[model samples]
Target: MSPVNPVNPANPANPGNRVGPTVHTTPKVPVASSAPGVARPRIALSTVALECPDAHELAAFYVRLLGWEVEREDTDWVKLRAPVREDGGGGTGIAFQSDDTYVPPVWPGVPGAQQMMAHLDFEVADLAAAAAYAVASGAALATHQAADDTRVLFDPAGHPFCLWAAAGAGDGADTGRG
Candidate 1:
């Protein structure tokens, strides 16, 4: 879909809130419809979208780190999906959209800094291996760590995510997978 202008008319309550363009998306499965003329809409949470300087570039990093497939793509937008399960159901997804004005958010936010909005979390059996793989996939280890069981890393576009070890794996022991 072509990008639309992001200037919405101002509301009295929300003075300068610039609403983003509406990007059309399709549901993974058909949702039940409301009765005709009911004016009700069924809503479901889909992928979590991130703003970045380059959609495809950041998406490539995630595709490597998470081993998810590209479900959809365009010049300014890309969507990724985890591999389908044996139950034939689609896994969770994420999307990236290009924004020339995108600013990378900072972790362990400081005053006047671009504070992190939200972060992704992945449960890992071997925290050491997962953290290593994430670093190799273009993610930089964050300077501040808040928890023993979680390692904070920033994606190529500066979105923070955690590599969390399962219970009792807090020491980040490495599995000899090599």
Candidate 2:
């Protein structure tokens, strides 16, 4: 028995093992809403998971910005839930997982650096006010902004998010699209 190099999965020590992305043959379709005759959708998105060096710290940052309460947490993970709406319905949550190898991603991406896979968006009544609030809440304004109506801010983990104002919020542009 001998160790195998993952970069070279095929070796004398190990054979017939492949390591790479898997391809899906079937076409993906959107899930239909629970209409009168439509069957209930089997899948529902509960949370967006984030990886950071400190789950608790990242979660705390979101808690201040979104007014979400900590729902569940352990040594390596923390979950925060949005405040229950007036209608008494629950809200989607964000989960953070602490990874020892976590590296802050670069925004306005560089040639070969790690780029953020995704980012969060918050709709605000006033773009300038929103940016100020986020800055006061431990978030830094990003130097590279993509649009006039949308201000970009970076969280402690270096994830870039947008504070977007609607069409009539002074920019006169449609902020409906993400």
Candidate 3:
């Protein structure tokens, strides 16, 4: 059996050639102009806000660690500006908000909580110097890894942060291993 077009039997090439004219219709859509009236979100370049028992104390620790200067300060809020290095890459800005009656979180042995909610990880050219600076800036070394030699430190408000030696400077080979 051969297939045949029921619409047109005269032209074999035109399978559906019965139509004298074809119509193409476009769906209607509401268009809005991208003008001054259009609403747009005011986005920030970068923001990292933290809750601490004392905003001033926490802000001071970060300022010393990252060499950041205070951009804004008040009784309840403090913001630090992360200075840009000679390289293109920039540092992070930290904001601290006061939290009254805040209890420090205990990791590992704490019931129902095995880890911290968030932690700041830093790569330093001189790990020893960084650790010393952190200590001088009111940070306590909480945990240390003998195998990898990385250390986890906490600020006065018990916010966990880490200091690790940067790679590619006689630290170790890029051993594809964690």
lDDT of each: 0.75, 0.76, 0.67
lDDT of 2 by residue, 78-115 (tens): 99987787999977789999999988878766658986
- Model 2 residue-pair collision total: 0
Per-model root-mean-square deviation over C-alphas:
12.1, 11.7, 20.5
Ranking by lDDT: 2, 1, 3
Candidate 1 local lDDT, 1-178, one digit each (tens): 3233333232332222211111235544566667667877677667999999999999999999888989999989999987888999866799999999999986665568896777888878777788888999899988877555667889999998887766666454532221
Model 1: lowest-lDDT 10 consecutive positions: 14-23
Superior by TM-score: candidate 1 or candidate 2? 2
Error of 3 at 121 (Å): 0.9
Candidate 3 Cα outliers beyond 4 Å, as residue runs: 1-45, 87-89, 113-115, 144-149, 170-177
Model 1 superposed RMSD (Cα): 12.1
The collision pairs in model 3 are none
Each prediction's TM-score against the native? 0.71, 0.71, 0.64
Prediction 3 TM-score vs. true: 0.64
lDDT minimum window of 10 residues, candidate 3: 18-27
Backbone N/Cα/C clashes per model: 0, 0, 0
Q: Can you tell me which runs of candidate 1 are displaced by over 4 Å?
A: 1-41, 168-178
Q: Which candidate leads in TM-score?
A: 2
Error of 1 at 136 (Å): 0.8
